[model samples]
Target: MTGIGAKALQTRWFVRSPIPLFRAGLGFVFGGRLLLLQHLGRTSGQPRYVALETVERPATDRIIIASGFGAKAQWYRNLQADPHCRVWIGFDRNRAAIARTLTREESAAVLSRYRREHPKAYAQLASVIEEATELSIDDIPYVELHLS
Candidate 1:
């Protein structure tokens, strides 16, 4: 694992509480530039919470990739099996969302936008994506939350 990856994992387990507050603060300050709160599958059908970077496409009515640490994470795999989920943006509680796997063309366009908008994250991920060889502008699953 890269240093950043190891650090992030360490922080996730070690620095738990303050991180949520910090993420919420970032959401407020940046306005949609914060972490995504996703639910994961557990043994008893309960959910696990994970914070990830989220991209929203207002024009397309979609929330883009989580791409957690470059899409190799367990959360990504969980969503693949079950598409229904809850998303918490900012101070919101568990809001319902539907996960959708984008078409190759759709994924390419969305990923392109992501690279353009979040260059730093893009840079951090570019090498991982390339190394995975499974990475493509296409086939990156994106989730679309249903707005009430």
Candidate 2:
């Protein structure tokens, strides 16, 4: 199957009813393997969630890149307005985090690492990253979830 097709399927299954079990299963299979991001809507104050492949710095902080599927995802924009967010890793939730938009150089570095580690997934993201790379930091927010 195509990459997008696979991701869509995964997303559909993930957001379906019985949210707890599905999320736990996802964490069991991909936790620490994936960075689960939770963002609040800029105006509506509703929560939004997405699972992203995570990269860690030498300092052991969790990092996630935007590279939104469509450059128009509301979560990305919400994060621009408010950098605070919650991150879930392996069924455990860390509610205190401050999102810091990465510089082009930083984003490129993170993307490079992600590509090296997850070639297949990264291939699917090529187009998004290409467009996202040029966007201002506010447009493509990259956040490092600091677990307290």
Candidate 3:
């Protein structure tokens, strides 16, 4: 259950079960915020995908996503290994986009603006982050996907 703490839920069967449906459903889940990032595995060199939330959309060709699980998340690491990737943005996907991890300052500014735009969701996310990691949302890292 959600109240079971972050670690337990992460390893539980129920948590993993939705992932398959998530991948299968792709962009249908959370409007355009949830996207299936298609990237390469760092060592295996195989294609991989992980659903991520689009926290900020400053421009039509650019989108920002936070590392909800921190910098050690597999998808974040994969992007560092290979900047080139595609985002399955529902109807029109952004292919061969450049994924750049934003600086701390940039992330802070982005989150500030994001909070104003999505006040209630931001508060909920902050609470979840605090519960999961015992840290503020500011501790997490973010990335900018520059589409071509």
Candidate 4:
């Protein structure tokens, strides 16, 4: 899906559905590949949640997520404002995790490895993000979450 269809799907209209289920604590159903991020709203200062696919779990306690919407994504901005956030991976929940935005070189290498490992997912995600953000996937920001 591309153009208006992809844009529509990328917007709240399509993305909002999973949020409720994720919030209801059913994110584990998606397996370890996805995570439910509970974060603070940038402006409202209210709690918000978004289900994001995990690009990689380089270590037992570390996971990486890509922000396809780049720096404009609310969740990304929120993490920047306050690195504190919570994440749910499978049946495991981390109450407080430190979020760190990855540098361009780091993200490039990470994405390169991701594409090699998950070719189909890499292409699909890149398309959705490109259509939504009107930019290349290389511009997408990646964040590392350190769980304690």
lDDT of each: 0.57, 0.60, 0.77, 0.84
- In the range 34-112, model 4's lDDT, one tens digit per residue, is 8888889978899888888799999978999988777888999999998899988887875579999999999999999
For residues 62-141, what per-residue lDDT tens digits would candidate 2 score against the true structure? 55656453346666778778878887666665546777767767777776777788787767555434443444323454
Stretches of model 1 off by over 4 angstroms after superposition: 1-11, 14-19, 22-30, 40-43, 59-61, 69-72, 118-121, 128-140
- The best candidate by TM-score is 4
Superposed by TM-score, candidate 2 places the C-alpha of residue 42 at a distance from the truth, in angstroms, of 0.8
TM-score per candidate, in order? 0.64, 0.66, 0.82, 0.88
Q: Candidate 2 has which clashing residue pairs, if any?
A: none
46 in model 3: Cα distance from truth in Å? 0.8
Local lDDT at 7 for model 2: 55
Q: Indicate the TM-score of model 4.
A: 0.88
Which one is best on lDDT? Answer: 4
**Candidate 2 Cα deviation (angstroms), residue 32:** 1.4
Deviation (Å) of 129 in candidate 4: 1.3
Q: What clash count goes with each model?
A: 0, 0, 0, 0
lDDT of 1 by residue, 1-148 (tens): 4455445544657524434664454444434554455556733456766665566556323466545344556666677677678765655545677777666676677778878888887766664444443454244556555533
